[model samples]
Target: MAQKERVGVVVSNKMDKTAVVAVENRSPHPKYGKIVVKTKKYKAHDPENQCQEGDRVRIRETRPLSKTKRWELAEIISTKAI
Candidate 1:
């Protein structure tokens, strides 16, 4: 089976070999029918330590590498200038 993948922005890269990614999406409320913005954070493995805060990245799901990491850095889509 193909592994799950997500495109999100890098939120934190303080931990060695790890980065936090925030994935945001819009969803309609069940009762109110109002659009809601949802954001989720995932801990992704970054072996090269190339990802930085505010960078756009793609992560793929994998076997758990740590207590909070089940995703691995797939590719960096874009880099933050600052």
Candidate 2:
């Protein structure tokens, strides 16, 4: 199996018992080394997942939870925003 990893910000925790995370990715241009931004959203499980907006978090790919949820909360790795 392939291991999955992602770093993101907790955009919302307003669901009944879940959190909506927005993972923004930054990469450098291939030739010029200029930064570029990309983003993706993941709906992860939050069992006692007391996270708030603007909080940095880590998530991992997992089996489907609902119709569109295929990720799970892995860990909260930081106490400050990057």
The 10-residue segment with the lowest total lDDT in model 2 = 73-82
Best by TM-score: 1
What tens-digit string does per-residue lDDT give for candidate 1 at 1-82? 9899999999999999999999999999999999999999999999999998999999999998998899999999999996
Itemize residue pairs with steric clashes in candidate 2: none
| Candidate models: Cα lDDT each | 0.97, 0.83
TM-score of 1: 0.94
> What are the per-model numbers of colliding residue pairs?
0, 0
Model 1: residues with Cα > 4 Å off, grouped in runs: none
User: How far off is residue 66 in model 1, in Å?
Assistant: 0.7
Cα displacement (Å) at residue 81, model 1: 2.9
